[model samples]
Target: MTATVTAPADRLLYKPEDAAEVLSIGRSFVYELMAAGELEYVELSRRCRRIRRTALEQYVAKLSPQSH
Candidate 1:
């Protein structure tokens, strides 16, 4: 039998490539952001990584200016 997995209510997580596309940057740049702790990611395995939509939103918010 095969098992099915459901994505989170918010939505499925973004892969590095998807994240890069969303940010309008390169995949390497996404890795750099992760390394610099500017972006958060989840490690599913030694070879698998994903970025939550909320984390991406938070990162962008951090880069945005505060309103008066």
Candidate 2:
């Protein structure tokens, strides 16, 4: 039998790539945000990390509007 994966809408955690997709930004920028502590993530292990959906929302909520 094959295993089933969680749908995007039902997911609480997201990989960096997934976060990038949701944010419409590049994956590298997601990593930069994580490195800079702008975005929060859960550390499952030394090599495993996942970003929470709330964290993404908070990040967006905190963005200042740009002046043009």
Give all candidates' CA lDDT scores. 0.80, 0.86
**lDDT of each residue in 1-68, candidate 1, tens digit only:** 22222335566698999888877789999999999999999999999999988787777767745589
When summed lDDT is taken over every stretch of 10 residues in candidate 1, the lowest stretch is 1-10
Pick by lDDT: which candidate is best?
Answer: 2
Candidate 1's C-alpha runs over 4 A off are 1-10, 65-68
Q: Per-residue CA lDDT of candidate 2, range 1-68, in tens?
A: 22223337678999999988888889999999999999999999999999998888888878877789
